[model samples]
Target chain A: MFYDRDPWKEQSMKSRTSLKDVAREAGVSTATISRHLNGSLDLPEPTRMRIEAAVSKLRYHPNPHARRLSLGKSDTIALILPDIANPFFAKLAAAIEKAAERHSSMVLLHATFNKSDREMAALERAAQNQVDGVIFITNRAPEAKVARALNDFARAVILDEDVPGGKVPRVLCDNGLGGVLAGQHLRAAGHRHVAYFGGGADLHSTQTRLEGLRSGLAQNGEPAYEPTLFVGDHSPTSGRILAEEFLRNADQETAIFSGSDELTVGILEVFHERKIKVPDDFSLISFDDARSLHLFAPAITSVRQPVDQLGERAVEILFSDAWDQPDFKALTERMPVELVERSSVAMPANKKKRPEKQL
Target chain B: MFYDRDPWKEQSMKSRTSLKDVAREAGVSTATISRHLNGSLDLPEPTRMRIEAAVSKLRYHPNPHARRLSLGKSDTIALILPDIANPFFAKLAAAIEKAAERHSSMVLLHATFNKSDREMAALERAAQNQVDGVIFITNRAPEAKVARALNDFARAVILDEDVPGGKVPRVLCDNGLGGVLAGQHLRAAGHRHVAYFGGGADLHSTQTRLEGLRSGLAQNGEPAYEPTLFVGDHSPTSGRILAEEFLRNADQETAIFSGSDELTVGILEVFHERKIKVPDDFSLISFDDARSLHLFAPAITSVRQPVDQLGERAVEILFSDAWDQPDFKALTERMPVELVERSSVAMPANKKKRPEKQL
Candidate 1:
């Protein structure tokens, strides 16, 4: 039979030896054996030997799920993110995985692709598996149910972008500062009107970035006009769509504050196909400098998120011992982000044109 | 007790009910209960009802490990790849994860980062977890022990690159074809002499690609000279070092065939820093068009691996019913690749210069 070749057969058969049998053979209470097996208790050498001998005699392989039940820890963390194919999330996940390894924990990855249903399904699966902690990341403004599902976990951390109603510690890049930097750079480059290409209008990151952009563009006084908004999801395909729209509706906007490198790639593709030159035609600043942007045609200017730190800190909070502290869930950490000025941003082509009214 | 506030406490207490207790209450054999619970048995309605009633009465929650033990299936697959942060591997993983999801299986990810010890550790962990299948991927040529460990799995598929002595189905891109495509493209552009930037000299890809390059350059006649080799691990840093070496020893080689986009990025960085223009100072072609090469300054020409198909096929092989067929383990499927002709390649500037004696 094909099943006969299964290597796990013998192991499964051995695992049939019950904990009760081992306890009975060791002449100890079930609690003692359970606690000792999970390394939650200290036992004398003689007692430890007896339990070990009994386990060996019976060939008892403690079931991982039962051990999890007894210990209330799974040694596994669920990393729920938008997409693994995206370089930004992929790098973040790598950092989290490395950090989790240091804590002797494994990461169960679930890619939601920014869909609500998928997000909920991932959460349900994580809960079913009883992971010790969860690191939740989303690009769009999640629904209330998403927040509730996140809150259900005893140990959860919101990462990258915010989930408005989630009652959990958050590890995020300073999105506002990223916007401020982009705004200051563009304004300094003699751009009076700029376009903000974002993932979603309702997203916390989008709003926060917009707020910071306005402050930065104020330039110690009121600016001529607010930046125009062109919103789409963070995928490259969305970037293409937004770029087409921006090109068609171009009035006086000379610079773009892209929410992510993903969008910048798409925008650049469109611009390349149309023979539109960057900087000379439109200055662009991308956030989340996760890709090899420095090697691009014009060498893109970007706001570099502390991606490694953001990921490591998220895992750190997940495995931290301070979960029980008062108001611990209320904590929010905004890791610093820096602007990498490359060759993308430049002066507006038509300096004589007045700034258009804000949309 | 801190454990009192544990959210899983109530669930854990209920899960203490044993399978034997449910079997006894239902007046059935333990094997029958196990088979029925695992959906491996067809029972009468009354019998199924009695078992369900007893389970509900006992508040029994079947341990996932015990269920796996009874069924000889974990509904999990382990993906052992070099690095999750690398875009190529990350995209491949995303495709694998999506495909595995269609089969109702979960993925357990372990990033070895091209380290032998970590590779062995990941394999050991997968074995301990009793994953139903494994998809192993490594950048460098692995040790014999690594191949042996991979062979130990009943269902394992070697992916992306070859692992010599591995007795399992392999799903890989046709490296020879990729090389031939790159060579022909460069040769067509009037490039008699070329430099091949490779990851490792011992890697199967390197050897196969070099062979194809020779034949392609021959083009039904003896080539002017064989392509010189500058080897380094597939990384941007390696690209930079190789670029420096190429510049130092360069004679009449006006074109380069980079083994991966990773190396191409590094090469570009060095070229940019040194003010050496691509297709102007040096023509270039890259393999693994996994990055956004089209957006680069001079869009890079590349051989595009069917990355998504390779990943999907690996998972398909892992779950296929063909594992028991004769010669199935000896199967190797090499997916085709295509040359994406962009702006990277150009005619040699000093066509009159005699090809320097093959380095």
Candidate 2:
């Protein structure tokens, strides 16, 4: 009704024939014509030629917009990610694209760069576009307003990290398990004092992983000391700054647990420039083995996020019909993470030559 | 006319008030209300509150799809790229997103994975979506059909590698200069016998770079044998296979000119595994310094592809008002490339210990 006076629609209607007309011209079902044009159908040579002839004669332009408008779904999902340049997010996007293809859905990318305003703007655009669903990812503590906006979506999935107040299905890597694996490995290597380089301290992932680290550190016995916290955003620049801070302030820390490969890159850059060797000057374990860590100078020890699984599961959850169930909206699925052992983890330099002290 | 009997339209129309109704209720211009909702305009507190109240009271939903359909243009651009997992493409996507934001356009990402069918599918979808424009990027030499499909778009800009039959304006990095730089650097270091690892032999970029390499290598004299060619897709796996083939068959080559950082990564993996030392056993230089080449094991030397400039120029060309000009579609702009010297190149092993013989 609103488009009754629209000039563009008037012009388009006068020029192009509809899918129904083409189907009738070809003496075939409308679904067949639609599928053939969509490149999703395998028609016989004669039938294909007939449909082609009908399309050409009738000037039937296949506009998915009209069909999607009528269906009340655009068959697209908005992927609002933090930073695409980060190898981790890049890998995640690639995996999501592959998985989304299985659902015959397209992904509209919105890079928020971890800025609050950009995040809100992306959400508004997604709403305006009438995307069928949204997958929201953030690297910092999002504002409550962001969560409220997310809650408005009929189908939204909070991915990779948490948004405090959003009531939506979440698919995230097991941060707790990742921390425990790092802590247990560090503890076994005789590392008593350690530093944790991570994103903002208020983030759900940061807090959860910290708690897991403490539990694992105490599993063997009373820990020598509480792991020190070095807070910053999950970015290479932040990592470089954090590494400088750690190097300047650290007194007895024998090892470090990095929150992401992004931070690890920064730390390594500073270390390489300063001639500080991993597992020699300080044993280190990084999370998010999404980068080519195996090829780094001293092959890195890292907690490998199941990036493909995490991405695939998020799409699977978003498209599931079970969203109507009361509990589906409250679901939070944590995929497991694995510890990849390489040369980065080793006996603490201070303890390598010394015998165990008597209790 | 097609939607006169559409049931979904009837339902939406009955439940939701039009933008005009909201504007009337708020006693403001429709443009003002629309801009406010888009978050592109700042209004006085009272005016904003009034518009918000009217939106809430009337339950007016701002559907960009409907507005776009009526306007005959969606404020979105389709980015058809080869692969997103590759750091080069990932960086390109990020830059394009930032640039598209300046134009208030969203980017719809479609990863073709260098598949012809997927490329055509993405192009068709872009047409069906009525996107404002398209930025098509491919790594390989595309088939003629792809070019024909691209030509059908009202606004399309070819980016990165060349498509043989594409008539649209193109934004590409200076591949010939990239080759010349690598070739000159190797020649200066006394690497007369070098191998070129590239993508398809038919690719415009690959061939141009190879030609430049030959010129650069022959700048001193034409005594050395012609450079050997090892061709495959621009992928790490392909690089590994090519490297293996080179190692198995090579005799005189003492240096390598790699086509991409992706290929360089694979070569390093195989070299690291085989205990072949860079600049010691062989010299190397890579193209597309999009990855973290500076932090690799040996700090690889590379030819940087000016990724940001390339992406920004593509978007700029796509949105340019020069499309009406007869010569606009024939435009092909090549951004300059820069060579970043690190520790990859060295003199040939045999020549390292001996002085050059007098002619």
Candidate 3:
């Protein structure tokens, strides 16, 4: 016991008063005082006023350190995002920061770059620091380790994409609706055959979006052959690779509905180089209007996810007091998506000129 | 009498082996040991190794709190940026974070949204926390108070276009060269009556770029009318406003040299709405090729700032030991800019038809 003395609990110094003192003075129990301060309990008006007066008179400051020591948590939230260098993520971070500020809490910022190692480090730091809640954002679907680390949180929220194994609260844009919007717009322009270029084939977002696109296009034409599925990461490099594959395969698809802006960038580059043209050789509709699509040469039509709104709402959900409920941590909120019809989609050229090409 | 009364200087009831003990064993002075651990000394290899071995054998671990008490600075750096959501700034932050990690330091992030009050708060917190250095980034021109607060830092660097008024070191892209490159490209494409749409007119970047634009254009012919200047803060909203103004007052300008990708987004939107075709209606050149301009419909011609290089170099400068040199803090590094030519700039359409309109 020689070195086991508690340095912080020494009796020689004056200590901050506890809730018990206020409770005793107000002639109520400590439970009522704690619950009332947290705004969790609905006490009668006179009782609440008496407790408030007692707290004021006692100069109760409620030691933040002590509170943290007891609950193993702080009044701070964290946002772990992928590729802060991407404009979409950057805008999302800004939205989260603003919402966190409104909640009177500070935010711990971590950019994961979609790397498992970095994601682990961020989560480890958040766990070690006992952050109140964590909002996890990753461009690619994560490994099981990521989900495990995320599941370790007292409170966590999956944002923008689905984490297959986690039982955490989630806030996401409507991936299905986004795909449907893109498909409907492209189809209206007389495109019957389509291609779905997306992120990882196994990712929840990719799967959901592909299904939606199929459903959306199914109504507009004859019993269709399944849209060509091109699987790659949602990145410009991958987009280029997929586009090269699409061109070499001699596809019948007249239009492409890309999963994200990163993919669209790559596809456009390859198309430009091979002398392939948008709406002329192939139509393109990109998801994530986060980039300035209107500035593109053809002014791209896109499925516009409410990026700012998604970010803001994710933060709000993370900081909400509903975490104490058994079902709250398992809640999911899906924000809506919209279609931005620009110049990218046009009536499929040569559709009637060479009907055989349509098949 | 009330407290420990600066107990650091006094040898209390403990082992008598002090830092002096290590010095004596290593045959070096105590001052040398202090300097070596503080990372302020440059000792020869063998001597440094001998001192380190002696200290390790003695089981001497310097008290972190004692070191902090002596140094009057913490192992932290402050990074203030206009918008954390900007891709450029996010990449900059990542680079800064990586560099800070190498130095065993942490970064404190603050988003000012180009506001003065937030800047003041950020600077005050950095000062109160005794952070080692600060890197400030801003979009709009800041007030004198912001500059004064930045100057108060023990070490500070003005990053990007954030703060030109600070007396501290600066790391920025070569905006003048960027403008010069754009102007030259436009001139070669036979565009003379060029209009400039950009960020704040009061910004040093804007003024220098304008001067360079004039100089570059003058190389081809007599100095033209002061390139029609439309000023706004660097944002898409401002860009839209500037575009509207340009359309309303487009006298005879057949080409536009936009200052940033942000402003170009708004300008392109307006053109698309008005059914004004690029290169067919007016040629254009853009600055800050950080965005995916090559994927645009017409494929934009742009001046590419060494964005990654600029970020890495800024971090290198921030942590460099050059701070102790004379006139060190007043250092300014202008990283070079490169031009990426695409299809956006071409022969001005109206010039051939109506040369008299150019006058």
Candidate 4:
């Protein structure tokens, strides 16, 4: 692919077919052709046809950079997402685009699939093209290189997950609050022994959520064993493997607090094949609530991260006046989380003797 | 919003700003300034900065046509997806971009959200920008207006779902085979009574899948009863409503074939809430196994539409020789679907056994 040594990009940049070809074919001054084509003037049939014919024959398309250079403001915004196929990111992008439409800004979407290289590439592209703004979403904590690339952008928002060293304001659901909700729900259902499935042990969101989960469980005032942690990539495949590992080393964990819907899917699949039943053999609570957890066989209990709110707030922050603020890029705001109770949680038969804590 | 109407746009139409400013600032002959600014020649150093300062101060961006008069192709493709937030569409967009990247083409992305207005807006914008090609996707069957807009493009590929009157080549999954596979699986599971939870009754995919269902069921020489149709929008909310309706009227139905994973989610929620046991109370099958359905509580059995393949194929079709055919717009091709057996289906218990028929 690199075989195309187009070193001519810097010099012979005007060498294909000129609009003069179109003007000549259209039988008009280049001015008439330009103005008429641009909707500044209404030309009669024959002239319009001539211009259209020339344009079609030459396959002429104006360079966006030239268009932008002329317009003084770009008409497009670049959206960087961790994974487009993830329901959460997808919904977030959808919300952002809808909001952007109000501003008449077109979106140039790039899915990084949670890869650093892709994120950097997307940022570089956005910078070179001079997009109006950028909405960046990443799952894992990015490296310094990613942060450095992101810092070059005058307007960018860190969304959903984290970019540890990024110098941009972030929009994130209160992950710790989500953890507490899940933990409390499980504890109230009479679960003392529990386990957690999260993305990465070192992630800010994961750690905060973990702290909240422990707090929620402790509210019962019972000295339960330390909750087991199964940290991995936030994907169904990872969830499956983790769930399998948990099952193989079966213990007294009566309830499980899964970090995200992605993980829940994997865990559920493993338990299904193994003939383990939720709220019967074991209860489960999931986070993010991005997927259709309610439609699952057990109607999974979930901590609902205000995804739409996060997305909207991200756009708001991206377009905010804080870019000039000395402390703007260093700020991290946490939106609250709520739990949508469903049937996935249940009291362990052994723990039925213990009083159920009311929510 | 429209306040910034360039007043000079109506005057003389040639000068956006007075050339007097450029000449005065550059401290050079107006001829030299005009020549330099219009790419007519290169200017000396001090003169260049003086010109640059004037250009920067006035925010003088050139007209695109003026630039087009100098350059050639934009080398950009406009990709219009029904919903960018949809994982399937997002994945499709990703694949198309990856392919286009190899061709050194950039993509102009748009998310229509299945709205006719947005679709029209996107189409018009793509047309106005003179995009090299377009790849269109929509869930609802589009109208003649959409077809006309799509037709206006030199190259367009209708992807995933259908646009009935759109005169563009399409690449889609074999809905018929998917439905047939579902029918066959349900039949094998000892279910004579089934319901097709479909997206829309008017959709081409719905009809094709229905026909395939009939054919698949017909294989046993049983001349099975035509499957019941539960029509609704594809959203999970619609799925829930459909599920409620199904529960209210269902008496003989033993299994359900969901149109998409989204609908299946709604159905699952209602069933789970009602404490309905899948495969035991009613077997279930889903289409577009884009989500981790295998991670569902019962590990849902489903007719897996090759979503990745669908995305890649659409891109290929957008650039394929098939589009060269004069009759390409009239072409309808169905990619095959496969059935992934899981725990969602089970033999009917205490069921009035249907008379066994030889195929």
Instruction: List each candidate's DockQ score.
Output: 0.38, 0.42, 0.15, 0.20
What is the C-alpha lDDT profile of model 3 across B1-359, one tens digit per residue?
11112212222212235788889889999889988986668999999999999877885655433454455444557788877776667767777776666665556677888788988887765654445678888887889888988776657788888475688888988888987887778777876678998777888888888988887877645774568899987777788899888889987788888888878777887787788888788888888877788877577888887777776676677667666678987888999998998888878785347544433
What does fnat come to for each candidate? 0.42, 0.51, 0.30, 0.32
Evaluating just chain A, the predictions reach TM-scores of 0.88, 0.86, 0.78, 0.79
Each candidate structure's TM-score, on Cα atoms with residue i matched to residue i, is: 0.89, 0.89, 0.77, 0.76
lDDT string, candidate 4, A7-90, tens digits: 223222222567788788777898887776555688888888888888878866544455555554566778887666777777
By lDDT, the better pick of 2 and 4 is 2
lDDT of 2 by residue, A216-252 (tens): 7776466546789999999888999999999999877
CA RMSD (A), model 3? 11.1
**What is candidate 1's CA lDDT for residue A160?**
94
DockQ of 1: 0.38
Report how large a share of the reference interface contacts model 4 reproduces.
Answer: 0.32
lDDT of every model, 2 decimals: 0.87, 0.85, 0.76, 0.76
Candidate 4, position B117, lDDT: 94
Candidate 3 CAPRI-style tier: incorrect
lDDT of 2 by residue, B77-166 (tens): 999999898999999999999998888888989999999999999988887676778899998888999998888777899999998899
Candidate order (lDDT): 1, 2, 3, 4
Off by over 4 Å in 4: A1-66, A189-194, A219-228, A247-254, A277-283, A348-359, B1-76, B90-108, B190-193, B219-224, B244-255, B272-283, B321-332, B346-359
Best by lDDT: 1
Question: B74, model 4: CA deviation in Å?
Answer: 4.5
